[model samples]
Target: MEALVDHVKTLAKSCDAKTRREILDQLQSLCHSIESPDDTVQRISFLNLQLAGLRIGADLKLFNILSESSSPLTIDQISKNTKENAVLLGIHRTLEHSYTLYQEVDKDAFTANNVCKTLATIGAQAAIHHYFDAMGPGIQELPDLLKDTQYADPEDITNTGIQRAWKTDLSLFLWFQEQPEELSHFQHYLTMNRSGRPIFLDVYPVLEKTETNMDPERALFVDVRGGTSHDIQEWKPWHKDFIQPQTAKGAKFYYMRNIMYDWPDDKCRLNLKHLIDAMGPDSFILIDEMVLPNSGVHWQMAQLDMLMMAVLAARERTHEQWSKLLESAGLKINNIYTYADTLKDSIIEAVPL
Candidate 1:
């Protein structure tokens, strides 16, 4: 193993990007072979340290301070300029070992690295605040909430782990409305996370090809339960008509993006039923969501699935599960346009029977 690792290092110095990626895969497999139970336990137990350090660093604007500086700054200089305690700034040292966000330059000075630049961004900062301050407690209560008799399975939206942690029966959306800053940050997080990805219009381009004979006055897209239509406005600048309906009405296409995963099976069925009822014989519902794999779920997908379970009493679904849900709502899936690589999210096109 040591000789193989040395060979990999030698290749890494001159390998092409594709070969380097292959080398990384080999290295990861080799590393996994040697990993032990204690290593796993230790890694899991120290997750709080990483999050806690990030929370403190974000609160103190440490990433910005480091990223903007021309050169490395000492702890004393950083503390004096930011007006935050020097000891609290030391918390970022925890991030260096695993995240590669910061690097020590001289003996006591530090500089920002590549990942730190991302952390310094406004959207990333907002996501950090939302996760640490708004959603942290909710995540911490998972064990206790799952054990409680009243929340056994906790499938109901009102009786969720989030409700237990937050001490409110209000739905997650309603709760977000009351927390303005958190809501804004949450929106920014979504935009930042989804940035650089192609919209459904870019991927399918079916709208451009499929001739629409509907009245020009009708909405081009109906973002059901979409709040304020910010994404719609940003995505569709020329055609800005959006409809949020509670009843059946036919349109050319109905696009639902990242909404259904916040609901359980029963509620999802009801929502789909409404969309199904509103569909013309030629109408299609393009549902955007992460379809979890049957086995060996990716880390991001697994984390998101558990997050939905904890916060919304909802879940991400597999392809089979999505098919089952669509069938339950009297709809059949026509096509699934999946993004390239590891992105689990897909555009599932369905039609009413």
Candidate 2:
């Protein structure tokens, strides 16, 4: 662990600015692994308390307590003015002790820090109002999940509590599909590095604009299980534009994103045969999806494999599994491009014979 930390520190100091940020992000994941159970529990408790405090502060208009004060105000003063219990109000002050807004001097006596003065100027109530508004159902689920440890399935973990809150109540996933601005925010959560450059913003455009760069005599791209929506339009405008052409002739390519993982060998073969019948022998088919590694046991990959099993009775495939799928489909895997940072995710190029 020490060696890993030292290696990350060295990489952070030696790498370029973007590489350094990426390294630091990975280091944060490592830190999460190293934290003691007790420490993790304490941090979760503190966060829940802080969230609760933020919620109550907004409701009682206690955020305005600092605004009304010329300097930092005591819990007694706030309780008396707001008509709330002094003890309960002190809990909020204690929860935010690390933040600059509220500083505890000697038991129950408080003073305004820099953040407090700023909050006062902006109206602390309004400052936290939006956060409280956005945190509705999902925020409440965290405390319960932290308390219950027996539920270990990643799918259940992904489906319940905070994940479900984001999925169902917030409609965050659907919102990203509908809104370009939201899609940008979602992209930040994925791996963005490529050979050393940010490939997402660079190489993505080439894959997207296949029609514009097409040759009239040849097929540019193919979508294998390409249905009504390719599901790539949220971040790839070229994909959205490419699929709309009236015909495959003239600088067009067949594009398939997230299509090959749904079936057993025989069914996948049938799907590919239909695609091959439609495409010219020279045309290329692009498949974007998870291509599991042949070696190494990744817990995340295993969990995702199980998700496919439970939901669709399908499984995530290794490269060998993918090879079989391609052969069965009457297509040959030309090249597999795995993005630099994301494990098991790849873009596969296949051609019909």
Candidate 3:
């Protein structure tokens, strides 16, 4: 019996005794030998399925539907209310399977559960609206452009110089200039949340200089594209005793966030000159923007740069590009604070010297 126990212990020891290198070698060999054509095909199919589900979900306003309900509803009920077919609704229901909506249900009937409630609170319907609204005009013209035979050849009249200019920066700039109301609507959507109240409410005391017995010098966040200051009330609670803008001359730091990237060099320079004329020489300008690095490629920045070009005929700037902009704006860079790892975005402090 003792010998049998000893034999059993020996077998266990042998099983546990594989060296790290040996295990790694075995794993490498197994990985090299494995072929996963089935997995590849399944992954592609899964992505396509997700895309189709999203399209159906958007069309049916599933986020908005679930928002109005306190409890989960079946696919048939959702379809009846939304006027969407049950088959498409079922696809979205399945797509939401991993969500909390699926977990609370004893059976799958597209119940509005905790996840759905959370999504509604986050204004997921409004978010979807924003997404589709941004894409609407562009998506409408694609089919017609594709069908036009005149645009088929690379060197054709439809594809060459005049066509290129119309499709490029000039056309977009003209559209924006002509469509002031539409541009204002877009700006309202983008800048609605960025108010002085939101910025200074919870975050103000920390940013204030505690050592000074004098009232904390308020930072002047000059939104260059600062449309009608609609959200100013949100900041009043936090900065209740702060000096009014008209009264506070030179006692504040100015901030321009996400403004300079939308215009050409000449226009940006003109904008900066106007800012400089308003503020004192001692006042600092803090620019919060993505400062593209001199080296190392960032795919997101590159993509955003292209979008800015398409929409505004503008591009994201590098640190050097920013310096040039500042110079053009009659301001000089005092210091630049770049967050490590996220090297694309930075806080650039400048002064009109």
Candidate 4:
């Protein structure tokens, strides 16, 4: 028993990302296991309200004000900074009660934690506001949507929860186009690397797989979506391709990170068909996404699956699901190199089937 305890202690202290997440998962499970039925329901129910709190906080610049201050801030001070009467201070109650995002030093007083500071950052604020703008309403509509649809799995992106809430036929991405602020925020949200997981290249031998077959006139790598700064480090000066104005007709390897889960299987198939048409004989596709397991799924994975359903009527797929989807697109999975144990972020390498 002592040895087992010592092993757990070691795992807790260690910097190994996989083990750290395992510890967190177990700790979360422990809480859920012992928690009362009332507490459990309250805990889960509050999650629905979290976006509301975050959105309200962002609008009032509450996180900004709190994060900037070195000392604890009273409600009066916060009110003064915000230039608003009777601040709701929803984030303080919602996030602190749930995630300890802020430090409630005393009654009606708060200080910034690391999480609070991140929330104050532009990207995080963008994520908070942009996501909440649609998601908050979508969540509200979801229960009715499910019941109205007779509890069917939402496979149609056209008439989704977000569309129903917003009262627009435009897809989530297209709707953002009309709102520049939200669109910029959406970009900022995409740019943020808050997941704290290893990139696909770390786990997948992408460089090794594609390096041997190089063509000078032809393109090497084309990143469709704007990638992170991490790309600058992993890929050398010659490797990065921001192919605009014209498509790279025959790229050796086309890489995308966390792109597929945004759309349903039909959309994914349609999306892939366009790409497959652009591929050369030697070309391969790399999809960086989470590959969910059949059982014992992590909460983050499960939560994201719920999120996808709520907004886009899309889903995060399991291996079997992924296989069927890709097979339908006329591509075969060469390998699935998973980079994170907790989220199971993987590089699904596919070539012509």
Candidate achieving the largest TM-score: 1
**lDDT by residue for model 4 (33-72), tens:** 9999999999878885777777777888888888889899
Candidate 1 lDDT, 127-217, residue by residue in tens: 9888887788888888887777555655777766667778898978779989898899898987788777655555676756357566776
Task: Give me the overall lDDT of model 1.
Answer: 0.75
lDDT of 3: 0.53
Q: In lDDT terms, which candidate is top? A: 4
Candidate 1's clash total is 0
The regions of model 4 sitting more than 4 angstroms off are 1-13, 84-99, 106-109, 194-197, 224-247
- Estimated TM-score per prediction? 0.85, 0.44, 0.55, 0.82
> What is the C-alpha lDDT profile of model 3 across 1-353, one tens digit per residue?
79966775566566632343344455555655574888557655675345445445656667568768667777777789889778876766766664344333545455555555544432443333433444344433434544564444221212222223335433443454665654554555455334222322223232453344334555444444343334333433122111123223453445555666765566666666655665664565566667898665466578667555434445788878888878866788887765322334566777885
Which digits, one per residue and each the tens of the lDDT, describe model 2 over residues 164-281?
4455533333333664643443242222212233322223345544534355545444333333332434432222222233234322445655545544455456555655655654
TM-score of 4: 0.82
Candidate 4 colliding pairs: none
Candidate no. 2 TM-score: 0.44
